[model samples]
Target: MNTKDMRDLDDAELADHIKTVRRDLFGLRFQHATGELENTAGLKTGKRDLARALTIAHERGIDTNK
Candidate 1:
């Protein structure tokens, strides 16, 4: 996902997307370990997406310290 796409999601939606992305990341890791993942580049994309979402969330000032 791009920054513009990430910005369109509300906090709740972003949070949910983060969870889903994390689950996907876990699966990707398993596939990589088993040499079943055909696209290794996807791992980096997922990580970047997760970081983008978190950065957008933080910029929204949602009191992450809590």
Candidate 2:
């Protein structure tokens, strides 16, 4: 998702999105480590997506550690 789309989400939605993104990113990392990932670029994309969400969360003062 882009920054504008992410910013449109409310607190609860943003938190949920963050959790989902983290899980997906973790899965990508695991796949890469196991040599089962065909698309390595996904790792970079996932990290960037996560960072964007985290940045937005920080701006909104949303606790995503949950």
Best by lDDT: 2
Tens digit per residue, CA lDDT, model 2, 1-66: 999999999999999999999999999999999999999999999999999999999999988888
* C-alpha lDDT score of every prediction, in listed order: 0.86, 0.95
Q: What's model 1's lDDT at 22?
A: 83
| Superposed Cα deviation of residue 37, candidate 2 (Å) | 0.3
Which portions of model 1 show Cα errors greater than 4 Å?
A: 63-66
Regions more than 4 Å wrong, model 2: none
Q: Native-vs-model 1 lDDT?
A: 0.86
TM-score of 1: 0.85
lDDT of 1 by residue, 1-66 (tens): 899988998888888888888889999999999999999999999999888887887888754332
